[model samples]
Target: MTASESMATDRPDDLPLPPGPNSYPVVGNTLGFLRDPFAFYDSLDDYGDVVSYSVAGEEFCTLLHPDYVEQVLVTEESKFGKSDFVQDAGERFVGNGLFASEGEFWRRQRTLIQPAFYRERIESYTEPMVEFAADAANSWIDGETVRIDEVMKRLTLRILSKALFDLDIRNQQSAIRDAVNAINEKGDAGSVDAFLPDWVPTATNRQFRRATDQFDDVIGTLIEKRRGDPPGDDFLSILLHATDERGEGMSDKTLRDEMATFLFAGHETTALALTYCWYLLATNPGVRGKLNDELDSVLDGDTPTMADLRDLKYTDKVVTEALRLYPPAYVVFRQTKEDVNVGGYRIPAGTSLTFPQFLIHTDDRWYDDPDEFRPERWTPEFENSLPDYAYFPFGGGPRHCIGMRFANAEIRIVLATIARRIEFDRVAGGDLDLRMGTTLEPTDPIEMTVVKR
Candidate 1:
């Protein structure tokens, strides 16, 4: 149905939208929502805590209360399904892999894939993570203010590729990086604009198709390559040869989708998180100095080890707080599979849900001083006191990111590796902007003097 058609009707059950600003008919606030989602959300506070609005002509309700998130994410998995918008747009690349798959397929694949990201296996990737990061660091010339975000993207992409595949990758074979990156930049934005199909031969759609195809080819090759001679177990090798209890292997389409998801899930978000960490460090020197002290005390010229996660408390705090400020998956989109009560509102069946972690994390209600950049909020005792769903960088409930362990470990190693040698003093004068995408990224280039600390 056209957005105009969708918005024109007030469902018999429709309650006046949970109290937020009205948007234009059809288009709604979709363009504005896409422009600066955080601000678009924050501005909604003029009305109330929970707000309902439409975007891209689809009805959505935002849950600002963390308690509500706990209910949505943890207590009621059945009530919500990963939104169709995501399932549809994601299908273009990730296929019916766990991330895009719903119902039994999602359940089955998740169980099979869950073990690969366990503590033991993720720990094994630490050394490779440090090695790749250290090697990436060596090329860092003194007195240069490199774009740390770009550096981070390159770092995690390499880590996910080599560590997951053990240097033996699948269908994504060679073009993996570019293909995945292209999709990251273009695939899912405005996916629900029924008036505009992404497959149209428009230049933007052509670009998206080109990128998605490259990504698909790469994942396809990796699957086929590994299936031929499955040896030396890694995530891909295991998946390449994984079969259901009935002895049937996944369809080629399924494997390609999953491989793309892993590639996307494994790296891009981590890079953004690390990028935020650097920005936070650049802006707050006091926190930076303390972090350096932790690094120096923990390791005597050796790379950060997994065991360091316990002692490098401040480093852990930095990463955690950065996630609070700019979560990798900025928003968790869920749609009601069936209507149920939430935050005292009767969310009807088929209503799309917008649970913005960025908004929830920053809401003044839960945080003492939400605007300030303070890592101490993540102190051992303090962190434990918070509700399980209050701080959801990796999200919560069954769908919490599987790669959390690996990402945390890799980000820490990369953070410490870079922090130990380079001092990233903020560019000192520029208005920074956050470009909202599949992940949030700093639109401003941080030009800092990189001196050997």
Candidate 2:
């Protein structure tokens, strides 16, 4: 049925399921989705805003319209819960941390964790953000090729480790990086390995287990060391001392989970954002020129401080545009907790729903030349004219990413700081072949030659 026709019906019982592609007998749409998720999701827009499909007998829906996205993420969020895939996969690595937990426990954890990302607390991280960006920029020899993705991941991880844990984890970065890679590979949404039970002995599972073990060893030692010492001012210290209305704090296990979540989600998303921003800049010289002009005029070769952010308008726009094109958290998944009507169709309880930011951000209805890298399109007037969920990279509602403010500030600062000293020239033939992972990742390394500006 058409969306309008479905919506005209008042009774949930009278609504029909959203239209979707025909599924195979047993595998459903699994092979098609796994073959190329981006293409698969893009094809759904042809069906309708709300489209239904299945994978291995599990029913799923994709909400393409921004209003439907708002209903699921904001207005009627409580009626939905974190999808089992997210909870099950995430818990294996991050434990019952904010990203995986549900119900009252999730609320309490959010309340306790909220203080770490307060404006004042985030502002304190600016020094480290700029310092790390500067360090990474200086270390790159002019005309030398670097893998932009790896560079960003390391730089962001160092910044986050210092800001969140109050430790310089340069020595431990290799192990942490390996663990994150292994976890992401195993947790990838379209991977067959993702659906397999953890108890099953497989090569991927073995690597995943070893990686998690190494991760636990590193984080466990840090937590234990911090517990015996006097409290300090980093995120770890804040979480350690933070008490609820009941005057209780998190246990060691909870602390480990929170640490793991912050370390992975906090750093990885920002890194990918920056990586894509650099890639976009290298390819679109006009935007890169405008960005360089802003950095030059604002900071004038000096490292950017938190105070310099307001004047870095174009730099911010470049970051915004990059995020629009390559949102690291490409899609968000949620499961229905009760029967609900969305866009005139009934979504039954326990159905998996996907809201693809990548799809919505590039829809022709919301953007002109949606695939083009045009930072100029992000004027304040233009921004105000769009639907709210159309541009949400960090998500929305009560469960919006706690690290949003922190990430925005960091992206602008790092982009400004590094751009002031260096420029990247894209290596010929280095195009990003996108892959859907725990976050959006390039199938091949993103290589670029560094040049002193």
Candidate 2 residue lDDT tens string, 342-380:
888888889999999999999999899999988899998
Highest lDDT scorer: 2
**Cα lDDT over the full model 1:** 0.74
lDDT measured at residue 111 in model 2 versus the true structure, 0 to 100 = 92
Q: List per-candidate RMSD values in Å.
A: 5.4, 1.6
Can you write out model 1's per-residue Cα lDDT over 1-453, one digit (the tens) per residue? 321233233443544436668788778888777766667877876865567777765778777667778778887777798988667656666768777777888888887787778888888888877887788678777887777777777778788888766772323344676666556556445333322456666665576678778766666676777777835547877676667788876777877777778888878899888888888888888998899888888876677888877788888889889889888788888898875666545677777887778877887766789978899887668767776666888888888888888888888888987777777766676756776667776766656666777
Off by over 4 Å in 2: 1-9
Instruction: Give the distance in Å from residue 402's predicted Cα in candidate 1 to where it truly belongs.
Output: 0.9
Give Cα distance to truth, residue 413, candidate 2, Å. 0.9
Among all candidates shown, the one with the greatest TM-score: 2
Candidate 1, TM-score vs. the true structure?
0.90
Error of 2 at 91 (Å): 1.5
lDDT of 2 at 308: 88
Q: List per-prediction Cα lDDT, in the order shown.
A: 0.74, 0.87
State in Å the error of residue 214, model 1.
Answer: 2.0
Give the clashing residue pairs of candidate 2, or none: none
Name the lDDT value of residue 79 in candidate 2.
89
